[model samples]
Target: MSCSEDPTCQELLDHIYELVDADEDAIDERSRALLAAHAAVCPSCRDAVDAERHVRELLRRCCGESVHAPAALRVRVVSMTTRVRRTE
Candidate 1:
């Protein structure tokens, strides 16, 4: 079934961006299962993930390796991300 037809799949797709931006080593077993199962079987989500990955890679390459944010900015970003995750 398409993700649009399944609530669980839609939820998975909704959070797929978090998966795309996540470091491989940061994913726990359950998170890995969700990503693996849906991304492997869902053609639309697989394509979406691929596109997101490409954009991430391109940005990293274009922005250059080792670009560092100011410490305050980094802290704010982490704090914001944490807050968002908590709310979710």
Candidate 2:
């Protein structure tokens, strides 16, 4: 699943966010390979990863040591998911 096989890199970039949220072992080999390959070839993706980490650190420092979505946002997300599921 190298980025070479998918030059757009969109899918791999999306999976990188998934990897951030996923448990350690939940990132499968293909995703890891794609990420590694993208990092090797794409400075932009590498910088994105670094920037995401830095933002997390900044939030932790600025927001009293932890970061979380607002309750209103969480409720909205849940409601939206329920609506989408019902539509499906």
TM-score of each: 0.52, 0.51
lDDT of 2 by residue, 1-88 (tens): 3436543456556665454454457677666666767766887666555544454454567776646757475446445554654588
By TM-score, who's the top model here? 1
Worst 10 residues of 1 by lDDT: 1-10
- Lowest summed lDDT across 10 adjacent residues in model 2 is found at 1-10
Positional deviation of residue 45's Cα in model 2 after best superposition, in angstroms: 1.0
lDDT, candidate 1, equals 0.60
For candidate 1, write residues 39-76 as lDDT tens digits.
88887667666655554565467677655446465446
Report the Cα lDDT for residue 33, model 2: 64
**What clash count goes with each model?**
0, 0
Top-lDDT candidate index: 1
